[model samples]
Target: MIWSSSRPQLGFKRVAVVLLVAPIVALAPLDPVQAQQIPSSSVNAAELISSLKETTLQSGLTVAATTVRTVETTTNLNLRSSPSSSSKKLAVMPKGTELSVSATHAGWSQVRYGGKTGWASNDYLRTVAKAIRAGELGKTTAELKLRQNANTVSKVLTTVPKAGIFTVKRISGGFAQIIRRGKTGWVQSKYLSTVAQKPGREIYIDQKYTSNRAGLTDIYWTRVSGGDLRESVNGKILIGDIPRNSVVYRDLKLEKTAGSVSGWIFVHTQGMTGWMKTSQMSRKSTATTKPSKYTAKQVLAQTNGKVPEKMLAAIAWDPEKTLIASPALKDLNRLNAAFKKKFGKNIDIDLAYRTRATQDAYWIKLGPYVAARPGTSNHGWGTAIDMPETYDYSFRGKYFKWLKANSKNYNWVHRKILEEESPYAEAWHFDYVGR
Candidate 1:
């Protein structure tokens, strides 16, 4: 049942006359439809809004209606006797309290509680939507880190891509513990938006790609013939292929959440975006000139310092286009691949194979101590490499140490005679021991 006082702005005389002549039916239970039909001028607009709630009277024989929409307090707010902030304070509404709103004027809402009606600022009130409770799936609103712990300084285990979805296992102070792809970690709770229900199917990103989801700005090129781009890594769907040495752009953020499988990087080439194996890409521009059609054996059979340029493989990762024996190029490429993975760049090369005339010129310019006697140097064989004389390639540098230890795995090794204390020592020299 619902009841309300006079809705009109009655003066003292009119209020007294209405009280004396009002009929008992004015206090009777109301039909919901009839209640709505009653004009706003006939009932107290400040006392009634909707008739959905049922409130039992103290005698327990009658009931009153309630509102259909509710507003919640977001912080402690002053309930004022009038809509103005300077109005007299009636009470203080605590955060999270739900209130039945009867009317709104200016920027304040008139709410009812405990037989009292007052106005509150709209700034501290919000519509009642279901809170994102536990056990729900949420999607990331930005690229975020999944750390081992809930703090920003904790070890970052992986990346949660923008729009990546995960199940919320629990939430801490400012972070949410989530599980994605069978791995569990914590991410900022504020960055996740809850979903109503689980998705019908999970997305197709490979977990390895998210371990380092940062955008890449470094340029690269295709190292294989007709480097192919597939719809997915290890996927049979072929998108297209680009010729060797074709420019590729890997620093991409397409679809906000695209990813790749292990050993594959998502890239854009020839106006298409797809996956290309990491093995088939390099920072070094491949030579357009093909390796001499002759076999490595036939080239080796020729006299030292007389090998033709056509018979040699142009080092694809070398910016200077240095030539090397075809047999050694593959292993060199492997070592460079690993180096780039560790250092985020290609190795700098100062020299590779030296022709007979070039070796003679070096001997006359640098003297016997610095240059190999014309034909006696290993540089004439197209198998020795000289790294640029940069601090990174020095005997005491990190690049040198890493190369000394790991290059052997790819059949490239630094000889002991090149140590700093040895005669004719050269710290920048490395040899292809495989051939």
Candidate 2:
């Protein structure tokens, strides 16, 4: 400390300066806002495009804004350099003009205009929203069958194969809720078509009706009474009191002959009386009537000369009017002859040749009639006859009974009788179907 130099030392001065600068040094923290403001070098073109694609896929926003890639026009149109007409026209883009995109300059885009690739206005060309791909739309398929349970062994709702198409309303997990043939049901989404959805209206089957006690009545019936059958009311046939809607099959005809009311047997459901219309009845497509495969000579031989020529002529003219064929008529003639031989007289015919319309009307009046019932009736076959009281008094009593018992031999069968549960007690009713 006491040492001193006569001359100034430059090296010592530089050393003093370095020592002072070293003491002033210290570390300071950076400002958060300033750091955030700095530009990042990480973002690039590929990253932006990838992010946009991923977002679109996840959000299900498949729609996009689209520009006209090509403008096809029938006539020559002006392509303005600007979006407005006041702007200069780049050129006249005639029909079949093709333009390549130069750039999307502003609200007005720049596309190759006229012959050159200079900027043409975008104001004229309309913009349209993009549509979803065909693969993305819902598809529909027809239902082959309806199962009561998930198991394949479940009960079937329909016997015949019914047709129905299903619309894929929604899809979730592995199951899809679809409107199958108008009914909503669940099906595997994989079963549906992956292509475009079908578009059309659906069709359905008609409703069915069932049988009843007071006679046939569909869901449409509101009232029914015993007096509905005119013949039964006139014949005074006492059809046992039947509860409404109770199903009854007609088996025999109950009629009053000569003031004697009795039941006469027919085919299936023998001694069956009356018919009921039910909600189970369904509409049939067609009904056909054919003549019996017997010749006139065979018919005459079978009847043993009992049937009248006039009746035969009538039947021949309209075989369908009565479900009787020549063979059936032949049998009825034989039965009629036998009855004549036993009872000593020809039986009278009450009603004959009832058109389908008339039969349907009668049923409707009676408040319900089932079409297909067991046992064949003469009225149904058409070769039969109904002996209503309005026809003749001889049609009632023992004559009618004797005829009923021996009529089958001659091929005659009683049509609608109270015993058959038929609304009408046709004492003289007879059919020609051979037993």
Candidate 3:
């Protein structure tokens, strides 16, 4: 049964009345006169006026009908008459005490225990659904490293072989601290599983994009001129050419700059792990742009300098109007597709892929404060674009909201909003940050 408590009011009330009346008033049948007698104060006013804050038996307190176990196994939890620790102590509750929570306030929970109504700290409480305790057996799915601490960078004490079962001591930060062959240490949480449940799926280091379950759902079909499944990332050892419509896993980390196109993503189907060009991949690919090598000073001096032939050749122009880095073009195209689908039109782009001279000219006109100093501009990297004719944050239309929710999947981000105290706060400026 779902247990709900009346929204408590912040007003002066006796502590005894608050403890006894609140829970009963919540379940009591009410008539018009009773309903009128029940206090209903504005929540906004209570929150705004801190001094007026008070918890009453029949007001402001919420309770749950379900029983929960205490997580603290070694020590007793102090039960208080009121929510505050400074309040009078009612009893000392032993570890693993099952409590039926009637209401919760701040960090304290009001529970019914041994025919007594009192409050206990919420920190040591856990629901029955997740009641795993220390010394329980668990197994690691893959060859996992046991570390000194919960963090990934912690020193490795030893390695747990694939499917190695161990006794769990505790869990923190998604890592399980366990005892294996009398040795206690921490291992990556995703790899650990309960005894009955099998270990997590194996994930190779190079296959960084395949770890998250959310990413697995985003499967895209192949749309390549000629697609081949290779054994390695460079695709030097070609296994064989797969059919054009084969489903491939998009590894976000493997997407790198290759010639004019930046959409070379590491993909795998069955046992074939290989690199595939963005053009060869159908649907959306989570590819991002690599940072430009030219610094502000470099760009100023290299106005006449040529962009690398490999990079220059990869530049893809959409309908001959907008020029973007070949690697980022797919994302840009995807963004446009989404924008068109939602708003019945494409986003109007005013500029993309600026030359050093063009950037220097903008710097001269807008100055460093209003614009990025020459080479540092994202536009020069061919991974940024200016939407509409001008940048304006004040325009909060449906188009802007759509862009906010959808742009990141394509690696596009509004720099001004993401960065703090940003000198370049253009509302219309979006840069690819996937790299």
Candidate 4:
């Protein structure tokens, strides 16, 4: 949700209620025994002691300024006895119910309603401004058009109900951009009041991932024979190398698709600050370094040289009578040459560098489990080759053995991971690591 990052915690004390409809009536004098409790040396000794205690309590306690806010949850939010879901629920606050927050916790807010106090989930609380001047508050005088733009000709996004309090941010001619519902929008300035307003409480936005333990702990360094650091999850940009035996932080802020848990994460090493793939990191901090010469640029150079300028691809071709096509030009050609030396026939292809449109079609047809989203697949990058869908049975015996033994020389490697671990798990699937 779009919101401020965090709201400062506030505290408020219970306030006594009083009515002013009747004339003042003095109370009877205290009982003789009650008055006798005071020391003879100090006529107001009891009162003085009570006053000192109250002063100490007030000094030690923090009082939050009175501010109003509203509930923005689609459904009513439960008000609990404590700041946790397990706490006994005291009430339910409905959507648009304006209330005053007395305090705030990590994900909960304490509020008093209907003469009772309870904690509510801060996830649904949207701060509202009261009347004030300067960075002050204003109330809508009438139903005013909240436009998408500053001008009256702009589309009316919604209507601000009469007497609705808003935090005015800026004024452009007749329209004002106000903060409401944890978001900023435009409203008419004439319909808002500049009367003195109560102090507004701060409310923070939730930007963290759903995973609770995300980014909390660091994965210890182990023998690092990891992978490449990418600019983003499944992105092509290579920022730095995540050496073996280094600290790697695992967090949920990175994108996590169903097939891959490895997402781009923040890494600070060798004075560089960029993101890297999580697969390249381990929990162990020390191990013998075995650097692989394989690099993405090497493959890019070969593919780019084969394709036209401004193109990030190579022509996908079918080597044999097989219906499958492959985008890895040099590697595919080498594999076919080696195959001819062993089985005297070409290896068939099942798929290759699919266009964005084609990939989207597969994503729609096969779903996320069976297909990678468009632009994120290695096939689209021209680095992966899928053998015939039935290559497991088609390339049997001698052909299979030769491929297993010789494919590595051409930089092809089969991945062994759970279907949930990677996008797909096909025995015929091979990626060109490097020569």
Candidate 5:
């Protein structure tokens, strides 16, 4: 169901109506106080189901038979009311103490303890329940190996040692489902104590966009300009007056003859919808990328190979142009490779190599060119790339935020933004200082 911000009370009323209208199956009675406390009216089950089916195969569904699933002391562990620590804390579960699994909500699995049923943050859980197997080893799958050490490597399928015994839940591909501690993930099927067969279905949401905030009704029912809502396969269209990153759930009707069933769609910021064939949405969590195939030497050589002359010329004559350098064809190549490694794509270099004559002219026309200023500009060398702010200006955009988080690993620094008395907050400027 879609939630509207305007009558929050009305939203509650609708939920109540849906609950009353929905057939009351023989499911466990949920704690109403716990359900009412969280504001998740925006979530749509249709969309969530669609998202889930696309990524992973469906598994059997069952309600929690117990109040909470406790992680007793193997060590001193934190116990929070919600799955996130940002929520409230009830108490820390001492060694050998029991904790209750209150509810499975969002990414967190809620637990109850100490006369309170709050959330225990899921971050500390070392294992995940669902994971696909990678390859077969003996009777079991091989232990899963991570490309890098990160939290994202949670549910990988891999081979386990033969002597190690694990409680097998199921088998998918070459992996075995096993519970390690209290968490579940894929292990080698050969290492499992036993295997069980289960039937399941996968579901996912058909979102219209990649960004969460576009094409949703929570902010408004119609476009601000009061026009009929029209969607296009190519042209950019503004959704209703929704926030920039809001996500929406839409139900689609498909042709039965075509073997297509109607489902929900998720909208992103770019006015595009992400379509899903399945019925469940997985929580957003970090996942590690495969290590780059390119060696560091190869990356450096490619970066130093060529600079886009036209891009540099565009920024050369700018009124605020401070310093400019002749494009180092090789350095530009290395920069591109480095960026792609970190961001999974090429770095957009607004300014490449510039001629000294053009630099001088700009300096004379304006004041001291940023590059000509003493002891300041990395542009003096050929290792800098200036990103354009707009199509025409030298400002930054969403891409800049990505650079800030990752550029350092590649020896790139955003010189202008780091300056205390910089002329402008130019987010697109980057310089490669050798690591």
Candidate 6:
């Protein structure tokens, strides 16, 4: 009972229904709106990913060229064959999609994505910056207003205090959009400083902080009468005073680990050399020609290798910031000064203090023979120091010979058990024998 179009029994009403559908399929005009127009769509996280297998667009917006770098598409954007709005579409690149930008023109960028090359709206392309596992960590240089949008005229959400640390979600133009304390907003990028934050380790980042590495050339001064520069361990062997208005320089290595956890700094002052309280030190000079009242600050004393971190100091001049017992650090400075004089370079330290947790990790990864037993090694006490396992530090190396002969004067000794003739010989191992 199928009806044919040429059948004489065909009704006028059925023919009229067919005529109505023909115009929509055959005569409808192509889509007229171009997608490249700016400020058209607000940011939408829901549309973050697009995977449109594209049919060639007959026409769309014209993209001239630009952004010769890796950028992310901020929204669902059309990838057109040419730069014009009427150009053919090559693909529908999803939001959050990365594109290799080649050239841009008239608010359009030539981009490559998903094995297809086409033009996309420059409005959706955002420049990329360095990324970290925790995202880009940054600190505000000054108290700033967090704006709802990237522009200064946008609504202010909150006032970010100076030195506030936050996660930078993305950077747009001169502004960086960040999330802090559960609120997200955009702020001037110029007032933001990127920081390298370590996981599982406490990093001391003050306003004076720069990065993970500070240079020895950095200046320091005494802010108070402070403590006597004896050692972090056994406060009895006083070397000198870090009196108020004294100038000093970091001892030994040229580069120091920035934001190190230790509260003691190994410093060398004219005619005085020892460990000082980092809390009483200032990176800025407070000394002036004008006389002012000075007050003495009491130094808190701690005992031996079992002391807390406040009693331990890092050789901040070293990039590794070798940690040691405060007393050992005082002796280390003396040894380093002499070694530097002879070799024109500071001694290289490879290993230093270790938390019990770290010791356990080493014991497992390196084996019992290679690594010190967990919780048993004097490294946990911060009294033991290990030299770099390099040719210069080897038993027969001149640096080793010079150190073996001279280090005793500084109360540091290479034990006989670690000698070349011993079964567990380690020319790099040295113990601090000072009280």
TM-score of each: 0.34, 0.24, 0.28, 0.27, 0.23, 0.32
1-435: candidate 5 lDDT, tens digit per residue:
001111111111112223334343422222211234334454434324432542343342323535333343322344554444344555554423344455654444555555566654333332322232321111233434311112334544343343333334446654455544334565544233221211000011251112222223322111111121113322333222221111123433222222343442323221223333223322221111122233333333432222222212122222222222223333444555766666576554434332333243334322331224422344433356665333221222346666666666656667654431232224556776542
Q: Give a tens-digit lDDT track for model 1, residues 286-388.
A: 5533434455456566666656545566676665455676666778888999999999999886566655554654454334434668786556677777775
Q: Provide the clashing-pair count of each candidate structure.
A: 2, 52, 12, 15, 93, 22
lDDT accuracy of residue 221 in candidate 1: 72
| Residue-wise C-alpha lDDT for candidate 6, range 21-136, written one tens digit per residue | 34333331212222453334543222222111112332343443333466776665667776555568665655556666787655566777556777776656786643321234
Scored against the true structure, residue 168 in model 3 reaches a CA lDDT of 63
What value does the lDDT take at residue 115 in candidate 5? 56
Question: What is the full ranking by TM-score, best candidate first?
Answer: 1, 6, 3, 4, 2, 5
Off by over 4 Å in 1: 1-298
- Ranked by lDDT from best down, the candidates are 1, 6, 3, 4, 5, 2
State, as a TM-score between 0 and 1, how close model 1 is to the true structure: 0.34
- At residue 29, give the lDDT of candidate 2: 13
Q: After superposition, how far is residue 317 of candidate 4 from its true place, in Å?
A: 7.7
Query: How far out, in Å, is residue 25 in model 4?
Result: 99
lDDT of each: 0.59, 0.35, 0.50, 0.46, 0.35, 0.55
Candidate 4 ranges with C-alpha deviation above 4 Å: 1-328, 391-398, 418-423
Instruction: Indicate whether candidate 2 or candidate 6 has the larger TM-score.
Output: 6
Give candidate 6 misplaced runs (Cα > 4 Å).
Answer: 1-307
Question: Once superposed on the true structure, which residue ranges of model 2 sit more than 4 Å away at CA?
Answer: 1-324, 369-378, 390-396, 414-417, 420-426
